[model samples]
Target: MAKTGEADADAFVEWFRAAAPYIHAFRGKTFVLAFGGDSLLRPDFVDLVYDINLLNALGVRLVLVHGVRPQVEERISEEAQYVRGRRVTDAATLEHVKDAVGSVRVDLESLLSVGLPNTPMAGAEIRVASGNYVTAQPAGVVDGVDLLFTGEVRKVAVAAIRDRLAAGEIVLLSPIGYSPTGEVFNLTLEEVATHAAMALEADKLVFILDHGDTVDAQGRRVSRLTASQAQRLLKELPEGDMKLYLPFAAQACKKGVGKAHLVSADVDGALLMELFTHAGVGTMVTRMSVENIRPAGIDDVGGILSVIEPLETEGVLVRRSRERLEQEIDNFFVDELDGRIVGCVALYSFAEVRAGEMACLAVDPTFRRGGRGDGLLAAVEEAAREQGLKHIFVLTTRTAHWFIERGFVLGGPDDLPAPRKAMYNWQRRSKVLVKDLEAA
Candidate 1:
């Protein structure tokens, strides 16, 4: 590295240029990002605010759910009763959950008050409301244990949240809900998001949590899974033990909530990283096969869109403009069924080195099990080969197993070609899978 005199202003330009297309695709989509108390109240909270400001400026609709379990517990006396080995909620505990969740919302709004291009997020903007959207019922009994005032989601006012988001409001949903019969209950952030996703029919239902432990048959953590797979995995979890957060995610996905993301609370910029770049940070659970894969044609913009609209609602794939995809048309491929476009994949390439990246690989659900993904993959690989490239790679978080089965193996960040690296955004940490087609 030369003297720090030469800043990579040029690199930033190239960086945004490379990312804007995909990022713009998500501009108006509803994305629910659940931030944990740990991440929110971290010492370096200013950095997090900056991230939020950036998200706002980019025009992404934001809905935030914050956790305050520690604060709630600390205030609860050492004498508070425990029922069935869980915190027994008394009058004091419920109030504290309200306070903790309230303080978090106030503090977050306060943080935003201090920064950003347009602080419409505050008073001059529409007032932010927290309660009532989540009409809840008591999480009455757990494992024969009497739980007091622990609210479980009964219904979500999807229309209300949707109206606000459509009006360009950043929705802040603190983990506090109103119950029927005029009572309030403390709800888990996961429960809130699950019901919200299902209600909003959100494009993406994501959880930024302290722990996750979903794995495939192999040793690797399967980062992407379908709702069915997630449900199957959930059923395997012992009753009253919902550790992975996949069951609710699967519930949301099955309910047409779109894609569900479970990621580390500690992974700063995980949201941005997942949305903006190819390499993403966490496990994404969706309801479809060939996630983000699809079939397209020059004249079938409507057809391409017809396939994407349903998935878009569930948030499995971010939405993009027909014109934009057309501009990048040469990068796309199709799955032909007697000349009908039943499946498609898009290949984004680094032409300087003749290397290419595969994206948007999808086939009709009925056409699945007919070797569509494999066939399309072969076609793309052949195209890459025809371009005189020696290797082609896929960056995926969940489907690494599928790629591994097809001769691709895990690769580190440095293993990526330099040009591609220039386009990598640190937020996503999208995992890489590579296969070599060159001969010795």
Candidate 2:
């Protein structure tokens, strides 16, 4: 039994170590967590709170937006009608909305304030701050039906929220906004969450969905999508909780939120798994293609160095100084993943020979096996073709097989363009390989 316990401990240590990069990436980043009131009724809600406390401990600034839909229904004893996505909050329903939102606010504050021994909050001193952070305007009539007390977020007090967050407080936003004239109006949590993320320029907007996972038409689970892809997929998804959150996620992305995540509140530690793991437990939506292959900018020098330095040390790549990289920065193309340069290749065009030399091809060690290297090569080849080059060549000592497998053929030094031949390093004795760009 003791040996088994030791083995389990070792596995856990390894898993924790693997999550270190995510931890570093999220530290000091602001995340807006949104959920419906129904989620609070689940048996696992306490566990979700514990996970939230864990995030807070890790230095993540949090703004929690919760919808009181179920609670409002319970207060009114009927389902509220929504026309064109705006709830028709009549005068009678507005009273229920106030009661429901107030009750939820108190409950969430009480839960987050817990500090009992032997609990997740035992030593946690989490400060929950709630206020009139969201300014509102009446949603108005849609096709002749007045929304009455229903409202939409017109503005968010970003400065005040930032102040609270700077002081290590979690800002809690109930789906209740106040007009400039001091009238309270019922708000939709989705709209509030989306606008808040935009106003705050948050790193992420997370929706705790009832549905656990997202799948495509073929029933295959999808783990990531760009905003454009999400918009296109939304048209095909069935009417469910996931579908309901898709538009809001896309809107958040459009307004510059770094990413939006849809994770099930039903799953224990789902938020942790989605944020800290490489293959997230839920679907991630981003504003643009997270993996971008484009021309490297002058600012990419540091990232380029980080990707190739190890390869240089291993003698797999030739050493290039920072000054040299700066001079040739325009010739380099990089594969940027989530804003990090993970792979790069430089295309040195030989206009006289109608040929290009692919050099300094490198991918970060951690990301090498994931086809980022292939993406960089494809990008460089396309760029060469655009520049009217008919052939592209590479001189590699260690990655010859990689180039060869990608359709490059063996060639001698004499096959190189005259200018390139003069600069060939005989000491390295690297093998030359070339590919015809116009070939099928």
Candidate 3:
């Protein structure tokens, strides 16, 4: 059942706190932030600045993309020119965009400097950089005008952004780019963030926009959403103005960015609130599937041991007799298909306060390519996550590549807990894979 009132708030807090350490693992990971001009214009600007600083402190690599739609239209109107909603990017207007984007970049930098003064953020040391990384698709003409140089993004060079990110620098993209053929193309803020996340394989794509967040049918905050849920919401609200961002958020996740957070810039410390509490601040859209991972009952032990015995015989897995497995049945989770178990994995969920071990994974041969392995692995991760475990370990003789493909990174035996390492036997020697799941 859906939670209510304090219960709902508590859920947000729990999810946040659970994610906190997992978020810590995100340090040094690249994140693409798309800030709408309306959001930047919010009265709660101080809250936004504080959140940015907090992310910096957490060791996250930041990419700030700010919108300038209203600012540009306002700039043109103030000069007594006809107020065309579109950006008039002729020679003179293009120069204005250069100036405008520059101004926004400088302003953001100055705001961040308030928290970290005397840090080399002025002049060339922290100057903005723009290049031909973005290719364009001409937007159709509006209001009888050709709409000139304003265009949408058709492609991007994500590697270039990753280079900047890996070098321990914050990249601030200004949604303004020069085409290969000497023409300039203006892009939407969300499009800029979406393309960058895809190109960079960022850990998350955050869209901080103006106005309050979405509400549920019951009027409570629609606090959490998976990728599919968000897509459903988008479909249900086709006529809703807020739906403009739905497509961008989905595209970001589809490109493998881990999450897309749609939150209110009005809420004070919303980032920390969403991240530090259990139920988060706004909707988090993710590509993660809805597979359930948990402890296996006694009945599952025989099947699991049967699967493990083959690998054990080949030395890919250590020997675990059916009797011994029955005693440890609580350590396993099975992947189910129409109520029949198709795959299973073991979780040692108590090596650290928020740590677990994934071991003895096996899938029915028929379900091999049906994503049962991935499902079992994800289920193990989810079980650990629900237990508030911050990290999980896997020791595999084969399938190291498979784990890596699923976001596992290489580690040494020493990365395991002391007891686990001490209990390790030469017969079980295998490459270790570790996944760090912290909150952001």
Candidate 3 structure lDDT: 0.70
Top-lDDT structure, candidate number:
2
- lDDT by residue (259-347, candidate 1, tens digit) is 78876555667666666654366667766543333335477666656655665565544457888877877787776555456777777
* True-structure lDDT of candidate 1: 0.68
lDDT of 3 at 177: 67
TM-scores for all candidates: the values are 0.62, 0.70, 0.58
Q: Which scores better on TM-score, 2 or 3?
A: 2
Q: Please name the candidate that would achieve the greatest TM-score relative to the true structure.
A: 2
- TM-score comparison, 1 vs 3, better candidate: 1
lDDT of 2: 0.87
Which lDDT tens digits does candidate 2 get at residues 136-165? 999888889999889888899999999999
| Candidate 2 TM-score to native | 0.70
Residue-level lDDT tens digits of model 3 in 1-440: 45577798997796666667657777887777777766666777756766776676667888888887666665664452222544545556656666777777777777665634443322223323345667776665767666566777877777776677667666778777666676777777878888888877887788774644655444456654555666777765634324667678877887788777776666677766554544567766766444333458987776676666777777877788777788778888887666566678888876455679898898877667644576577667767888888998898888897886566889988888887888766665788888887632
Quote the positional error of residue 51 for candidate 2 in Å.
Answer: 0.7
Q: List residue ranges in candidate 3 displaced over 4 A.
A: 1-20, 78-96, 115-133, 140-147, 238-241, 289-440
